[model samples]
Target: MAIVALRAPLKDLAGGRSEVKVDGASVIDVLRALEAEHPRIVGWILDEQGRIRRHVNVFVNGELTREDAPLSADDRVQVLHSITGGTA
Candidate 1:
């Protein structure tokens, strides 16, 4: 199982959890498992087409990665939402 770390609102959506354990061979699989456990995080990580959102970033073992990236049992995954704002 990989340890997935949730940031900001994602963590809030996951019941205030900073980390979660999930089993998967790929990043998307891990995300799917996370969604299964926390339905509120559905569209926050993945889109309607099941793709990672552009405003969202995912990292594996501290390196940015795609959804299809392979994973190991001890791997760590981080899901972060990009903060955006406009100058007044």
Candidate 2:
């Protein structure tokens, strides 16, 4: 199983938590499983098209991962904000 750590800002929407783990053969596979667990976090990390949103950054083992990035059971996934600021 790989671990998916959700940042604090996003965690607020996930019942105020820090991290979560999911089982998968790839990042996308684990993300799908995570969505099943934290359904609310679905839109937060993924777009309506079921793809990772641009604003939300996903990193594997501290390195940003692209759609084609390969994921293994030993990898770790983290979801965070890459945005700077919004309306004040």
Candidate 3:
């Protein structure tokens, strides 16, 4: 299982969980498993096409990764919402 770490407000959506372990071969599979555990996070993490939303960032072992990126059992992942500041 890969350990998925949740950041800030996103953690709030996961019942205050900072991390979760899920069985998956890729980032998409991991997200699916997480969504099954916390249904409310489905829309927050994935878009209508089941793709990682543009505003959300995913990292595998500290390197940015796409939803299709492969995962290993001992891999670590982090999910964070992108923060953008408006122009003055």
Q: RMSD to the native, candidate 2?
A: 1.9
Which 10 consecutive positions of candidate 2 have the poorest summed lDDT?
79-88
**Whole-model lDDT values for every prediction:** 0.91, 0.77, 0.89
- Candidate 3 structure quality by residue, lDDT tens digits, 1-88: 9999997677888899999889999999999999999887878889989999887889999999999999999899999776743245
Q: Write the per-residue lDDT of candidate 1 for residues 1-88, one digit (tens) a residue.
A: 9999987789999999999999999999999999999999999889999899987889999899998999999899998765643245
Kindly report which residue pairs in candidate 2 clash with one another. Answer: none
**lDDT rank order:** 1, 3, 2
The alpha-carbon lDDT assigned to residue 31 of candidate 1 equals 97
State the lDDT of candidate 2 residue by residue for 1-88, as single tens digits.
8888887766776677777777887777787788788778777677778788877788999998865577877687888777753555
After superposing candidate 2 on the true structure, give the runs of residues whose Cα lies further than 4 Å from its correct spot.
Answer: none
Candidate 3 regions with alpha-carbon error over 4 angstroms:
85-88
TM-score of each: 0.91, 0.82, 0.90
Candidate 3 residue-wise lDDT at 19: 90
lDDT of 2 at 11: 78
- Model 2's number of clashes is 0
